[model samples]
Target: MWTTLFLSYSPIPEYEYVENSIPTFVAIGGFPFIAFHYPSPPMGSDVVSQSMWPLFYLNEFFWLIIGTILTKLLPQKIKNYSQIRLFCIVMTLIISLSGLGYLVLRFD
Candidate 1:
């Protein structure tokens, strides 16, 4: 949720056209997935071409709902299994490390 909020507010330049073309602002939500582009109008132009990616928001909402449902429905025995806990921890570490690596490479 915090990531989504931050990404929505802080868009990074992802692509640029020719010298005269407008630059595209891209924001990635939901961690490493779901990116949307916001195109701004060129200077001194009244016409604005902007769009919102509903799926970007929808995807997060969908996951939230699904996660809530699964948490409520799944048995405690399965949720509390040692192997499951270990797998979740490992996966979280891998994802975090990969994301950190990407950020370091990108910003460096």
Candidate 2:
């Protein structure tokens, strides 16, 4: 995830030039998820800066690890494995719903 994020920020002049214009959501999909639901449309920089960004990155890192381990380390017979899979599915649904809610609720 970090690699992808960093690569996304790679010092390509075109990327930088493109990043300079448009709403934050136009630069990346994530903000649109929030701004779409937010009561007020998002303004200002869309770039994820600040110490919290590392935390967000780390959170995604851990989720990736968890997903990998769940798929690779678990045996098929474990009853809880099904539950875990369900939980993951539910998590994806909930996240998408939230994004959709953001999009639907925002005035824009």
Q: Which candidate's TM-score is highest?
A: 1
* Residue 38 lDDT (model 2): 17
Model 1 TM-score relative to the real fold:
0.37
Q: RMSD for each model, in Å, please?
A: 9.8, 11.6
For model 1, the run of ten residues with the poorest summed lDDT: 41-50
What tens digits encode model 1's per-residue C-alpha lDDT throughout 11-84? 65544345665554333334434443333423323322233336545656776787799899976666558888
lDDT value, residue 100 of candidate 1? 48
For 1-108, candidate 2 gives per-residue lDDT tens digits of 333332232222345445446433333322111111112145533333453345445646675887798879766676677788899799888876774454343325
Clashes of 2: 2
